[model samples]
Target: MVARDAQDNVSPRSSTTTVTTGAACGNPVCGVRQVTTDTDIPWGLVTLPDGSVLYNRRDAHDIIQLNPTTGVKTNLGTVPNVQSTDGEGGLLGLAISASFSSDRWLYIMHTSPSDNRVVRIRLENGRLNTASEQVLVSGIRRNKYHDGGRLRFGPDGKLYASTGDAQNGAYAQDRSALEGKVLRLNPDGTVPSDNPFGNYVWSYGHRNPQGLTFDSQGRLWEQEFGNSIMDETNLITRGGNYGWPACEGTSGTCGTAGFIAPVRTYPTAEGSCSGITIVRDALYVACARGARMYRAAISGSSLTNVQTYFSGTYGRLRTVEPAPDGGLWLTTTNQGDKDSTPNNSNERVLHVTLGN
Candidate 1:
């Protein structure tokens, strides 16, 4: 199969093999290869139109461009005013504008001195133009931890952002507050008129949702970090309320009493999944504490055939995205994870090829 993107650039031919029921290779993931090592918690991954990857170094506050084929890297410069909370804060998510080829806009979600915010900067001539920084959203509460930060462009050509409750669960239920909610906005930093609350919020009642992606059907899917008992993967709906403090997973009265239950839930120990992306007909999530990758077949509005892979093979997976070559690009956050011993070898970006 080959893909001709919006720019009319044709990708190389790619194919996947499906094994029969009695085949020795039961797992769809057939190969794994290390692409880059010694990254400082590569938190965000995005494949550019030119097929080069742009990723963020969480604590470093720098964006680096990597040529996937040549193994060469170039520093795209640091984002100014980005400060780390010494925990989960700093430069967190990266996304390209829909009209990137013309607009040259690159969006980022990061922690500032006072709060967590989303900003867009110019990526011109292979360098980040810090002077072109424009704040798209701000005033989000930020703490030492739980600063939910992930940015993605939905199929509707709107900017969507996931924000954490900032360690305060009460914020999750507050529609007036920007924390603990997913927000929708116009490309120019204004709230869309069609936004459910007449504000930037698209959905409410979320703890620390860190992952956002759209499926082939243009439906938005989210992955959230739970307080203690359960982590959730939700099918986002307009004006929908996902029980955060009131209900977690299916534990409380979710899917009833005006609350929406998660399509799937996992024990926190087994799935603090973060980055999510759909490749082909499957949804893939990268786990942190779980040290694994999750693959689930998307069946209509539900996810089926849930399977976990690479448990403990990678210290802690942080981000996963569709590769330009029709595979997967996964990043590890083992550097700062409390469970793992600090080691240079632990942090890496890996390429994984899967079969049908």
Candidate 2:
């Protein structure tokens, strides 16, 4: 993509580096290109099938397309009826229909005046072209924090939604509540007949799950935020309960009835993972306070190898999407929070090339 960093240069033969707390990474010649830099909070980065890039600016209420070849941006239009809460509302996640050619339909998870929900819209001619918007689902509790709003269609052609506990501890164990659970439904928002609970609910007991992606094998995986110290990347299974509120990480026993444990976890509190993407043979995870990108090699639904890159070049990196150059795209997020560093301007999109 566009930034000034040296990312376009990653080759299949590029060398790998292992990093830890207070460590440095990337080769002296590894190309990590900073396409552009600004102070706007970027919420998502999505690469269209044709290699074009679309992203959202959480604070600006704007969604724009970036020329993957160049760094230039094309403003699509403001997300209407958005409710950008003090720190964590507005637009969060985005996904395009599998039938993009005929449907040209786009889906977004955002907090509106009412609640956080997934809504669909027609993208005729690639503009917010019309006012045609349909609510796939609604009535999710919205708050200043803990609103899980990531939406992705799984390999089964069902809409998979990640919902946060809305900062309420009780919701995690309340199977009747939609919060703190992963819901699977048809494109129309109704519960699938085969769902374990026979409702939209698929899994429960979570705090605020941010990233969800199914591997090429159709196995579901997720990256979640911890209360403070721990962050997790989990392998999601049917009807599995990921303990939250009751148990933060692997620190304590799940007790009785059983709960699914994370496949891997990062003990470094600052390494708060915001998004996860599975491309080819690796799982790429983006960090917020950690300000770095991590790669985990998976083998048969397990993390086999792990590494980190870009130690601290960017501040609070948030989103990572497939890049046009067979690499990946990342965006910084330090500028969004009022509590961030003074005069923070590290916000921008960075393109990175991963080894084959």
Q: What is the lDDT of candidate 1?
A: 0.88
lDDT of 2 by residue, 219-288 (tens): 8888888887688888888888888876777765556357888888886455788788888868888888
TM-scores of the models, in the given order? 0.91, 0.87
Question: Which candidate has the top score in lDDT?
Answer: 1
Give candidate 1 regions above 4 Å deviation. Answer: 1-6, 9-27, 338-346
lDDT of 1 by residue, 1-356 (tens): 77797699899988886755754444578889988875477877898888889998888788989988887989899999998886788888899987998999999999999999999999999899999999999999998888888989998899999999998989988889999899999888999999988899999899899899899899999999987889999999998899888888888767568798899999999988899999987999999988999999999989999988999998789899999767899998876653212233348888998776
lDDT of 2: 0.76
**Lowest-lDDT window of 10 residues in candidate 1?**
337-346
Give me the displacement of residue 16 in model 2, in angstroms: 36
The deviation in Å at residue 180 for candidate 2 is 1.3
| Candidate 2 wrong stretches, greater than 4 Å | 1-30, 268-270, 338-346
